[model samples]
Target: MTPAARVSAAIALLDDILQGAPAEKALTVWARNNRYAGSGDRAAIRDQVYSALRRLRSAAWAGGAGDAPTGRALMLGLLRQEGEDVDAIFTDARFAPVPLNDAERQMPGTAPEPVALDCPEWLEADLRASLGEDFVPVMTTLRDRAPITLRVNLRKSDPAHAAALLAEEGIATTPNPRAETALSVTDGARRVANSAVYRDGLVELQDAGSQALAQAVPVADDARVLDYCAGGGGKTLALAARVSAQFIAHDAIPARLRDLPDRARRAGVEVRVSDAPAQAGFDVVVADVPCSGSGAWRRQPQAKWDLTPDRLAELTALQSEILDDAARCTAPGGVLAYMTCALLDAENAAQIRAFATRHPNWTVTETRTSRPDADGDGFFLALLRAPAQTA
Candidate 1:
């Protein structure tokens, strides 16, 4: 498809997304119906759709849509922001967008702080407070694609070995500074999944920050660990890759773990699926509880707009409850790793502080954080040591 045609396709997909249909769902439906659009066309359109979403508010403002948003306006705004030739793409050609009128051709005024940052107005204050002097930079960084990172299963292969194997398959990689096991894919990323290295479990797709979080876990060589809220078991596999511990995975919604067993097999790790994880006596308990996913908005931009204050509050409440349960599962002298993919203090440090207040016996050990930056997505890890004896 021509570049102009791709822009037109993006506009239609954006309209479906704007009307409350999920971004993924709309894209899927469009692909199924427009099967004539080749793989490259679909990928290009997807990039355009996500890019616009990442800059939704600012793009709308650029397109002169102050209160109401439209697909055409968003595309125009995105082009304006990127300093692209709007006339070239909106040519009214057979498969192109209609040409811009005098109103659209005119430049728009400056956008509000939240709009310019593509953050929801209601969330602006909290994010600002959470990020402090780095708020602007962090939010601005979220307006682009996240790096495609892979976690080398150290049990099966090291980063150097993984890089060599990936290079043999045409995928270029650089070791991630955030975690020793992580590699940032520089080229041929689309082929990584089908590459020999990945198929044989030398590496698995994971964010560098997440790999760092797994590395932060303090465990004994023969420790018994429970991933209390192991959604899809990424953390579980990560932990197992680093240690020869007895690992167990569980989630409140059991169906979320349907693929974990296969993932474990591929990674050469044995992670027991547990339906009775609550009756735990674990040396390490990892609680990667759910959150607003604010730090990962770059990868899932639609969620950035979907999150509401109420939903955030509910998440914090749920996080606290999960912390309590995870704490219970931590054996005496064991470590409880509390973590989140949120940059918001309400979900990270503040939650840990509240948990400390609720459970006086659990002692906070160490905390590490990385706000979304050049290295990786925002992640928080806090280790708490249980009392030497269970009282």
Candidate 2:
């Protein structure tokens, strides 16, 4: 497809997304119907759509309105692309859009403020509270595409050997400092899903920060560990790799763990699935509950725009409930691990504070947080231990 044609495709997909279709769903439907579009064409169109979404507010402002639709966003992105004025492309000709009116032609194209730089206006204060003075820089980092990272299955192979195997398949990776087994795919990331390394389960896609978070949990050999909210079991797999533990995984939505068995098999790890609580108490109970995913807006920009104050409150309540329940599963003097991908203070520090207040017997033993500027998705982990019996 021509560059102009790709722009047209992005505009159409954006329209579908604006009309209530999810961005991924619209892109998938478009690709399915337009089988003639090659891989490169599809990738280019996707980049255009996501780039516009990441800077939606700025694109709207540059297009002369705060509510510019898909076509206007496309035109503004194109304007930034070739440094051409919007008038040059919207000529109302065949295979092109209608010409801009006199007002659009004269529209003021100014850059947006820091809040409008990446996230919506309503989330500004929350972001500030979460990130403090580094909010702008963190949000700026989230405006671009995230690097593709892979966690080597230490149970199967060491990082060096995995990197060598990936290199044999023409994929280059660099060891990530933030995660012991993480490899940042420096090149050939597009082919990773089909590569031999991925097929053999030598590596699995996961953020470095998540790997670090799992590593921070001190698990003993033969220790009984429970992943209480093990959605997709990524953290479960990571934890299993870290120790020879009696791993148990469960989730409120059992369907999320359906593929976990297969994933565990592929990764050559044992993880038992149970809907009911384990009869044996756990040495460590990990509650990686759901959250706003604020730290990962770069990978899923739509989420940032979709979050609301009320929804946030509901999530905090849920996090508290999960923490309370997970604490019960931890043996006396055992660790209760609370985790979330949200960078908001309400979800991270505030949630921890609330948990500590309600359960005074549990003392926070350790806390760790990762920021977008720190080479991984934003995350928070708190290790709380129940008080030992007094003599």
Runs off by more than 4 Å, candidate 1: none
Off by over 4 Å in 2: 68-71, 78-94, 107-109, 278-280, 389-391
Best by TM-score: 1
User: What are the per-residue Cα lDDT tens digits for candidate 1 across 1-391?
Assistant: 8999999999999998988999999999999999999999999999999999999999999998875889999999998888899899999998999998988877878887878888889888888899999899999999989999999998888889889989989999998999999999999999987898998888999999999999888877899999999999999999999879999999999999999999899999999998888785799999999999988999999999889888998999999999999988988999999999999999999998998898888899999889998778999899999999988
Best by lDDT: 1
lDDT (Cα) of model 1: 0.91
Q: Where does candidate 2 clash, by residue pair?
A: none
What is the C-alpha lDDT profile of model 2 across 32-150, one tens digit per residue? Answer: 99999999999988988887777777666666656655656645654654376555556666666667777666556556565256567788877778788878888888877777899
CA lDDT of every candidate: 0.91, 0.83
Instruction: For each candidate, give its TM-score against the true structure.
Output: 0.98, 0.94
What is candidate 2's local distance difference test score? 0.83
